[model samples]
Target: MENLTATNLYSFYGKSPVLQGVSFDLKPGEFLSVLGRNGVGKTTLLKSIMGLTDRCEGDLKFGETDLLKCSTPQRSLKGIAYIPQGREIIPRFTVRENILMGTFARPDGKRDIPDYLFDMFPILREFISRRGGDLSGGQQQQLAIARALAMDPKILILDEPTEGIQPNIVKQIEDAIIQLNRERGLGVILVEQNVPFARAASDRFLVLDKGRVVLNGTSAELTDSVVEEHLTF
Candidate 1:
């Protein structure tokens, strides 16, 4: 479980720069939260790590492999799973089908969502035959995470897992993440606006302003003033 490092990362949309020399390290089995106001390039940084955005310059590496050279699918196969902000689940597909999609990066013949996923998200097992669109927003979020876990990723990048969800469901998701990190040694990078949730779950914090990391510290070092200045709108 080596760290994933982004060194001097620069990303752009067309000719406009979004991330300027952004960098961070996600250590093994560690939960790191990225906090920023809207349009401050938090999502762009996540997309850059997943290779969804074009890199202007810099390097992204996990262990000995260079992630900048990998395609999105190749990144998935290499053990990075991203659950984007929207919780993109196929509306018409059954919950089972949506979860199964996560395994596409695996060898063609592989079947069955891992048993532990069902154990962690038992609600998904109950809704296996239900259409994704029929579930509540919270349920959809859970399904999105379950699907990501089906890929057996080494690093899970979650963008705002608490958005628009009920408090109870949010707690469930938080518990699941903690369990994964504590029991299975999964590394997580959380991009979130919910400061309380981020403070509760993450061991370290990274705050981005405009596009650069303005602060990097342990959770204990993330003062209220810092959160207000850098993360609040």
Candidate 2:
């Protein structure tokens, strides 16, 4: 696993800057959560890291390679697997096909889905032949994660993995995330609204407001008062 660093990062959507002087780091195998209310550039932060924004400036380095100069596919090849909000899996594709898509980002050019992927989410194995759109929201979320994992990423970047998932399955998703971090040694950058889950799963946390980081510290310091002040809507 490698480290990710973003210094004085600014991302723009057309003429407007959505991320202003954002700076943070994700050390090897560490889990960092991005926290904020609606429209505070939380999602934008993830997109900026992935090279999906209209324009970006400042240093974003994954290990020794500079990310700002890399294209979107180049960045993905460098081991950052991004699962954006809304679990954008191909509706017409079978579960197997969807998972296979992740391998396109591999620099090795290998196309096989790793066995660890099915091990992480057995339901994906059970429904290997099913169409992606036929699954429930929770299942789709799992498929989204599984697809990202199929890339064999060094760091998994998730945007609200539990959003709209059934309550019964929320814990399962949470546990899978922690397992990927602790057992498999994958670094994670999570953008989530659930205060309890973020506080529970993260090593450190950052709170963004109107495109700037306002609060950042160890997860132990992300107290209820901090949530009430910066995260609660």
Candidate 3:
């Protein structure tokens, strides 16, 4: 149960800053939803947490360890798994191979895909030998999540997981996320535009506007009015 904390966090791309003075505390196994309209730094927030920005300044820590002191790879190695928005599956790699790639971040250096991943998303098991690029968008998203889970991370950062995914499987993905949180005690920081799902899945929510946190509260406070004011574009 590691706690991820960010204080006065700033992230830059080239000369411009995308995240400014961002701060939050995510407790072990807490489900947090990062909500915002398009291009309000929701993705960048996740990137900063993952150390994907060119430059970052502030205090980011997992438990007692400082994340700002760690490299991108080191962050993952320390139990932070990031599943970026595009579901960046390797085009030439097989599903199994793509999933195996995530195991490289394991501190134990274990390479086997966790058996639970297949049980969560059985389609991945069915297409174990198929090329990652050949899968449908929903399937690819599932694969991306499976790959991250294969790393056996303590926390997962997901960006727009259900976007562009089919409605049927969207429910499946959402269920898997909630199941992971409730049953497996997986801490999740999810960036999602789907308000209903966010409200349903998150224990807490943060509303980011133009790179800063303008509003935050328990899930019960994320009403339609808040969504209209901050989350709706």
Candidate 4:
């Protein structure tokens, strides 16, 4: 467990600027939530850190390594795992196959799925041969997260994890995230719109407005009035 740092980060899409001088630090074994309304560059920030965006200017570092020049796959090998929005699973692949995909970045040659991954998601064991496209939305989300965990990442970036999901499954995912942070010492950057869930899961929070970080503080420092003013529309 360490920290991921983004200093003076700026990103663009063609001529349009999306993230403007966005900066933050994710601590070791800490859960940090990025909360913002639609089109506020929340997803852009995640992509920038993952090396998937067109970086205009920035310095990104994971632990002691500079990540600004690393490729997406290189970043993954450096211990960064991204669970993008929409669960992005390969529909035709089986549960086991999807999990195995995460091992592609491993330095070792083995392609085996760790036993602990199955322990964390026992349902995966039952559906090892089932195709990912056949699962429910919640089940797919679980699979997505489990797949990322299989990478043995030091830091996990999840975008809108609870989106379009049931309350029960949301709780399950939340519990799993907390366990990962507590037991495995995994650092997490969670970008979410569910205010209540984000507040409950995150130790610290950052709010983006118009592609800039407008507010930031610990979860306890955020008041209901502030949440209503900045987050509610």
Q: Count the backbone clashes (under 3 Å) in each candidate.
A: 0, 0, 0, 0
Candidate 2 residue lDDT tens string, 102-144: 9998888899988987887889999999999999999999999
Which 10 consecutive positions of candidate 3 have the poorest summed lDDT? Answer: 224-233
Q: Give model 2's TM-score versus the native structure.
A: 0.98
**Candidate 2: regions farther than 4 A off:** none
Clashing pairs in 1: none
Q: Write the per-residue lDDT of candidate 4 for residues 54-161, one digit (tens) a residue.
A: 665778888888888788899999888999999999999999999999888776656878887778778889999999999889889999998898888888899998
Q: Each prediction's Cα lDDT score? A: 0.88, 0.93, 0.93, 0.87
lDDT of each residue in 84-140, candidate 3, tens digit only: 989999989999999999999999989989999999999999999999999999999
Q: What's each prediction's TM-score?
A: 0.95, 0.98, 0.98, 0.95
How many residue-pair clashes does candidate 3 contain? Answer: 0
TM-score of 4: 0.95
Better of 1 and 3 by lDDT: 3
- Model 2 clash pairs are none
lDDT (tens digit, per residue) of candidate 1 on 1-233: 67899999999888878999988888888999999888889999989988887555798899888988888888888888999988999999999999999988664447679988888888899999999999999999999999998888888999988889988898889889888877998899999887887888789999888899989999888789988778776
- In Å, residue 152's CA in model 2 sits off its true spot by 0.7
lDDT-sorted candidate list, best first: 3, 2, 1, 4
